[model samples]
Target: MTTGNSGSPISRYTKDRKVGEGTYAVVYLGKQVNNDRKIAIKEIKTGLFKDGLDMSAIREVKYLQELHHINVIELIDVFTAHNTNNLNLVLEFLPGDLEVLIKNTSVVFKPSDIKSWLLMTLRGIHHCHRNFILHRDLKPNNLLLSPTGELKIADFGLARAMGNPNEDLTSNVVTRWYRAPELLFGAKHYVEAVDMWSIGIIFAELMLRTPYLPGKDDLDQVDVTFRALGTPTEQNWPNVSNLPLYNALKVYPPPSRQELRNRFSAATDTALNLLCSLTELNPGKRCTSTQALLHEYFTESPAPTLPSELPKNDVAGGDSDDDEPENKRRKV
Candidate 1:
């Protein structure tokens, strides 16, 4: 586990196996020779750009190195492989994630299970916001679950620092389905509330066990969001129409919050209220992470389950747990 002049990161690990692949990098499941601890090594593809390192790689390493929390993925080490220009990121390996749990029909999710997952997800986002960093991406797939049932937020490639009012940001940050209304309207100077909206959608998904809004394109995304939560107008979201792309959106009659209740009948009053606050059209009126943590939902009946008590299937992101079909992330 030593980083010598050769800068070979693979030298310290063994039993390398490819777990996933993306446009910019490939992930491998490996173990530390010294401690036999498992790890996820992200190998960044080189020679794709004129610059030395890819921007996403740089941003991921920079922000992840600074963020340290139980709900956040841990960046163990970073080094390049010998005889190669590629850089590798050593991260704490998570067995599975929330998406897998949701897709696993074998696992029945109680309200308490959803509460536990939401609490931990909020905790992670709270940590990021408290540090003034914005996790632009927040979806079920990005919420990694450890073997102990602890949830960890992963993927910092789209994350950036907040609180700079003068800096312009791109609205096309979050994934299409989970993107906030403000971003869809082309609001450049957005805040952390963007992530909050995604969390709200995730909460809804947790309750329903299906994607609340699966849009095919950008317009369809906005259309689907408006249909579910009601379209934002000048009265609801001040200055929203002034955004660059607001004029492109078609008109939609605002639906009442009762519609949301009907859709998520499984949610309690307190839980429903929290989701409403999170998916507020107006960022100014949206609930912050701190406020959401104190919501009455946490104190209600069927309290959040203990991490160790969560449903444990033999499947833990690998085939070793052959109790079920091998769940594989085909295109993450």
Candidate 2:
């Protein structure tokens, strides 16, 4: 085990307060003594650190090191404690993430606020696609809000670089709920459209202040999605029925447009229409992330707010104490 200057295995820069804990790692709020700057440190367990480190962690470090954008979380450094067997990843510590923000506040966002979030989210995802990187995970939790109210996409654990368009990459990725229909249908060969599906889900969630389609599992998720948007037929999603996992689930007739209009009562007509276009059940029919970026929702009057101008920490207000265990640091 290795420690920092403080001589403890994990070192004590600032006493850690638990922020978020996931299956393989726990994120901590810490500071570097030399500069006294706050940072988010993700510590992977020694036992779980496999032959090298996890591929997802390695991919995140490799891609973020070369990809820099205001809308994307910045990775500062990577180091190991003096005596510990685990690896430490240091990242810019943003005050809060969108998940906590949406949950804590009851404020109905102005259309402008919604557009700002949508635009920033697309800009960040667009940058990733331009670089040939796909952010497979893009739910509210992975989208962090800076103290300045700007949103930065974080948690690139499931991200991957695209290869030949015809090649089949990994199938077991993306969280179940935000997963695109192609992924749920076992289309190993996919493209950036997968990310666009998540963006559509996110857009609906932002408007509704809840998950757009909350399914209990993969099958249920598909059922919920098709139920809302209507099942894809040969005319709707041409190649969808040919997908690997495509099977005859009891087919229900498509729902009327009136049903959809009533379902998204809070969303604007333009926004609802765009959501329908982007969330097409067939990968071939789904809109690209870049196309969605150019949609009228972003071009309307009272345009989206520039990220730098957004209010910082408007979503959540909290602080961390230095006396807690390093592993327990909570994200602000």
lDDT of each: 0.83, 0.76
lDDT, candidate 2, equals 0.76
lDDT of candidate 2 at residue 208, scale 0 to 100: 76
TM-score per model over all chains: 0.92, 0.86
Q: On residues 13-118, what C-alpha lDDT tens digit does candidate 2 reach at each position?
A: 5535667777667787777665667778887666765476777678778888877998999987777776776777788877766665566565556668778998
Tens digit of per-residue lDDT, candidate 1, span 119-171: 99999999999988999989998998777888899889889997568889988
Q: What is the lDDT of residue 10 in candidate 1?
A: 68
